[model samples]
Target: MTFDATFWALIGLILFLALMIYIKIPGKIAEGLDKRSDDIRTELEEARRLREEAQALLAEYQRKQREAEREAEDIISQAQREAKAMATEAKAKLEAYVTRRQKQAEDKIAQAEAQAVQDVRTRSVDVAIQAAEIIIADKVSGKLADELIGKSIKDVAAKLN
Candidate 1:
């Protein structure tokens, strides 16, 4: 009995499989796949490491920024305190200067008042002497009376001055 075309095709298929096995093609394919997998795993690990490093750098920069902001606030507060202190000192100086000037003005006013009182007193004394001399000269009529009046006027002037 002769083989049919179906029977020959089955034999050819079996030979092709056997040849593939003999050449170890399946094992080679599996090895290539494993090597590719290892390379991918290594690249993945490197990527993870890079991500961690970037996160650390970001945290460090954020910390530095916070510190800088704190320093800036401190500087601003210090400046404000100093400005207030200077303003207070200036105000104190101005008040003192005003007080001194006011004191000087008061002293001058007092001096002027005293001088006016003294001038009025002196004028009153001079007028009283003139009136006394006129009355005495009208009432008296002798050299002796004139000498006595002159002496009395000199004594009154000396006491008043």
Candidate 2:
């Protein structure tokens, strides 16, 4: 038989229907493939978002670490300054205490010297009075000597006051 347009068209349609039936593939299979591709795309997008979030967290942690280090340095410096100030104050207090003690010792020494001089003067006066009494007792009668000595002592007391 000679080939004709109508015959080829009919043959093409029969072949196409035969392939579809023989493979037993339904139309829903293509739709399922498309849906699976969309699911894979969405999963990839979620993975990218998670990666970005992790990067942000890492950056924040680094910033916090730097701040902590700076704060530690500041605290150490402040402590050093405070320690120096305390040492200075202690030194000044020690010097002041030493000066006060020295002044007190000098004053006590002066007072002791004055008291010793006063005691020496009083002792010398007592010795002089005893010597004079002994000389008078040898020179006169005992009763006369006693009366003269009493009168001299009263006169000397009046002159001293």
TM-score of each: 0.64, 0.66
TM-score between model 1 and native: 0.64
What tens-digit string does per-residue lDDT give for candidate 2 at 53-147? 99999999999999999999999999999999999999999999999999999999999998898787667667767887888877876778889
Best by lDDT: 1
Count residue pairs with overlapping backbones in model 2.
0
Question: Per-residue lDDT for 29 in model 2?
Answer: 76
**Global lDDT of model 2:** 0.87
**Which has the greatest TM-score?**
2
lDDT value, candidate 1, whole model: 0.93
lDDT tens per residue, model 1, 1-161: 89999999999999998998999888989999999999999999999999999999999999999999999999999999999999999999999999999999999999999999989988987888888778888888699678978888888879877
Each model's C-alpha lDDT? 0.93, 0.87
Clashing pairs in 1: none
